[model samples]
Structures are given as structure tokens and as C-alpha cells.
Target: MPNLPLTLGCWDYDRVQALMDGRVRPEGIDLTFLNMVVEETFFRMLRNREFDVSEMSMSSYLVSLTKPDRPFVAIPVFPSRFFRHSCIYVNADAGIDSPADLVGKRFGCPEYQMTAPVWIRGILSDHYGVPVDGPTYVTGGEEEPNRQEKVPLDLPPNFRVERIGPTDTLAQMLADGRIDAFHTARKPSTYDGVRVKRLFPDYVEVEKAYWRDTGIFPIMHVVAIRREVYEANRWIAMNLFQAFREAQRLTYEGLKETAALKGMLPWFNAHVEETFDTMGDDFWPYGVEPNRATLDTFLRYHHEQGLSPHKLSVDDMFAPETLEEFVI
Candidate 1:
């Protein structure tokens, strides 16, 4: 049989290149990998008709698998870990001590629609019962190009939000005490000067907290294959899974080395290493079966908050047969 052409896409160029170069091997599956950011990969896959490889977000991949027109099987990219959304940083001069102090304060964020904002609002609403409706909210960019559309939450009638430009500007505003608090989707280590605090430390204690609490892990990103190509060349999908699994394992085991050699931006490198370390053990298999409990919880949370338009079931998000083959 002739070797089929396979395209494996990823955002982290160093990690993907390491895997392809044989310096890191997850589970022995070799692939022709293509490195790209998650958004770019998704758009490319969606636009291409002839491509057989799958392109998807981790969340969407599972959702698609459960759909009747399941485009491609889901695969595990890495282990699960507590992923904290936007870090809430208050300038020392702001005099805001806790969640309650956020009222009437000017808050800076990357955006109201991004994942960090969603998680932050959810935490505040579900835990503190603070009304986000009345606070002044500031977005980072004046205009976000190709921003991912998110479902809006019920902001308190008293809440006000405005769009500021760039993360640096937002941070500077916080530093100058212009904004009372800034919510960033970036990990805590990414920022300095201001004291960064997790919004819901108790609930999101570890990476698996989402899985344990809601049984539905938020789909971060996924490899999506075109439908026709998936049907015609099933092996490519399977092979890709094997390759990723191997890559993930190698990446985890060599986390320290990978960190050292990659020489990423100091904050980003630290955050990536910490994340990999936390998820090294509970990683999912590179196949379609998602952590049902995690998905269920996420859907329930989103649905209750009116974040998700439709209530989706486990079967509505993943393929049973594909999942069965990859469960670790």
C-alpha cells in the first residue's frame, strides 16, 4: 500500500518540530507534520475541500465527533491539567482586595468574548454571586481581527465595558491605577509587577478539576480531517493519532530538556513547562473518546449560564467507536 499524505497541524513550532525530528517520540507513529496556530489551522481545514487530514479545536473536535456528520475522530494531544482562565491583577494602589471590591471599578480584559472572560464571569457569578452587569469592562484591542465569537453572559445592568488597545496598554493601565483590575487569559507567570491571582482557586485547583467538577473538558483545540478524506483514508487518521500520542509522551518525559532547548519567552516557557508537568500523568489518549464527565460538566455550566446555545450530550460530541479505541 502506498503511504498516504498526512498533515498534522500544531501551534507550537518547537514542540512539533522536535517530534518530527525524532528528538522526541510519543508512541512511534511518524508523520509529516505542519505547524500552525490553532485559529489558522481551523480556518485552513474548514476552507479546504481536498484535504483529508482533520482540523479542529479540542472542544469542537469532540463535539463534531458526536454530531451525525462527525467529520473526524478526536485525539488526545496532552494530559489534562487545571487550566485557569484570565488572571485578575489589581494594581497595589487600586485598594481592591477581593471579588466584592470589583464593583464600580474599571476592569481591563483581553476581551469580553474570549475564554478567560467567560471563565472569570462564570466564577464570579457561580461562586461570589457578584453581579457583573454593572461594572465597567475594558477590552484590550480597539478592534480584534478574526476574533472568536462567544456567547454573551447576563451582565448586571450597572456594568460598563469598553475596549482598550493591546495587552501592554491594559497592563500599563492597571499599573497606573487607571483600571481597578485586569483580567488576562494568559497564565499567571506571563505577567509581572502586579500581583496575579486566580479567580476561582478552590474550584479549579488542578487541571482535572474541570473533568472532576463538570465531566467535560473545554475543547482547547483539535485535529480535524475533511469528511470525504476521512472516509476514503481512515488509516491516515489513525496514524496521526499514533504520532501525536508518541509526541505528547516524549514531550512530557523531556519537559525539562524541551524547555531548556526551546528558549521560549521566559514567561511563556515557564507556563508551558508547568502546564506539561501538571498534565503529564492524566493525559488523554490520542483517540476520539473524550472525558465524558468533563464535557458534561462544561456543557451544563455553559448551558446554565446561557453561554452555550444548545445543550449537548456526550454522544452529541464524540464517536463511541473512535473513543473506545483510544482510551488509556
Candidate 2:
């Protein structure tokens, strides 16, 4: 009997590197891992279903569920998580001194449905009183010109979203004060601090305080298998899930090693300690039950913002096999 062949597309993270290097192979599977940055992987996967398994934006996945013939089914493995406070950038001339000041200003994003912006908008609306529909949204390329939304959106009538010209870039638009603030996952090169600065200069402390208050570590990306692939081989869901979990466990072990530093940061250990102190040992958690609140909150945001028709439950987003485990 031959092992089933599969291909996975995702970013090159230390956590999932074990799988990339062939060290954490799933049982009864022959895996081919394609390591790329998130943007390309996401664009390809959403546009074409390029890989058998791929990294998907949580917001986009929710949007997909709204479609009658959705393309993918996800496991609980979140390869990427981020604090989006640092993702908000504002022009110096926009009179936006704080998050609250941005109401009625021209807010820009690469796309309204991008995961980071959804989390950012929801957090700002919930915490800072920045109304979700307060600003007129300008969407287009951030660095390059003419970028389009990977997934199409049919937002509510109240929300105002418009696109920039084919030759226009949001980085230039932001620098020119045409757009007051920008919410994005990738920081544009035009951000000189004097011109375009982060909305939260003290974002680290602010994010820590947010975590302390809310206990929600925002999940940025999830791993998904194409629906056809998943349907044909349902067992692959748990096999891949367990493989990813092992890879993440290896990552934690490597990060906690005291013998020598893994990367350039001298205070990596201190940062790790601070994370544990703040969020506990298993800070980056997987599975449905442990992440219910965060997932539910995101779903609520997705629905309210008109990306999802209804708020999807945590159980609705993940594979059933990954939802439970057998105990001794």
C-alpha cells in the first residue's frame, strides 16, 4: 500500500519548520510543504485552491462559509497569531492623535475583509469607541498599485467602502494625507514615523494590557484542506492536525532551551517568560474548546461587519475529527 500524497502551503514559521524539514511527517501520508510568505500563499489559495492544504485567513474562511459551495475545510491549527494594535498607521497631518480621533476620517485598508483589519476594526469599535461605520473606507494596494480583494464582499448598506485608482497606492495616499489612517498586516515602506506613524506608539504595553483585560490572543491564520481533498480522505484531518501540534510543541521546546539562543534576540528568553507570565505556558493554543471565546468574538465581528451572513459557531469553523481526542 502507498501513502497518500499531499501538498501544504503556508508561511515559513519556526513552529511549522519541523513539518517543512520532513521531521514531523504525518502518519500514512507523504507530504510536500511549500514555504512562502502569507500574502502569496493566501492569494493563490483563495483564488485557485492551489494547494491540497493551505493557510487561510480566518476572516476569508468565514466569508467562504457564507458561499453555497465553499472551497475548503479547516483544522484547529493556527500557524499565525498577531496583536493588531501595531498594524494601525496614521498620517501626521490627519489630526488623528488617538484611536478615538479617527472617527469620520478616511480609513484605508488593503481590503476590508483582510483578517488583521477585521480584528483591528472590531477591537477599536469595542474598546476605543471607534464606530465600525464611522470612517469612509478606502481600499486598494498598500505598497504596490491596483491590488484587489482576494475574496469578494457584500457589506451592509451603511458601510462606506471605495477603491483607489489602478495607478494609486495606499502608501502614497497615506503619506499625502489622502487617507487618514491605514490598518494592515504588512507595514508599508513609506512609514518614516515622522510621516506615517503607528496609532499606538506604546503598542507593546497596550497589547499586553489588552490581553490581561480580554484574554483574547487574536488568531491571524488557520490551516485548511481543500473540501474535495478533505471529503475524499477525512482521516487526513486528524493526521495533519496531530502533525501540526507536534511541530508546534517542538517550536516551544526550542524556544525554551537555555543552552544557547535560537535567533538574534538577546532577551528572547525574557520575552518568552513575559508571555508565559501574561498568557500561561500554552500561550499559543489550538483546538476548538480552548479558543471558543476568541473565535466567537471574531465571528460576531465578521457578522456585524457584513462579511458573514450569520455568526458562525466555533464548531462550524473546524473539522470534527480535530474537535475531540481519545483518552486512556
Top candidate on TM-score is 2
lDDT of 2 at 284: 95
User: Tens digits of per-residue lDDT for model 1 on 127-226?
Assistant: 5666656458876532242232222244333446665643446655665667777775554332454453443345346435544554434444445666
TM-score, every prediction: 0.61, 0.98
The global C-alpha lDDT for each of the candidates, from Candidate 1 onward, is 0.53, 0.92
Regions more than 4 Å wrong, model 1: 13-19, 22-30, 37-82, 93-95, 103-107, 111-113, 130-137, 140-169, 176-179, 187-191, 194-219, 231-235, 252-280, 283-290, 304-306, 326-328
lDDT of 2 by residue, 269-295 (tens): 888878778789899998888998999
lDDT of 2 at 125: 93
RMSD of each: 6.7, 0.9
Backbone Cα, N, C clashes tallied per candidate: 47, 0
TM-score, predicted candidate 2 vs. hidden true structure: 0.98
Model 2: CA > 4 A from native: none
Clashing pairs in 2: none
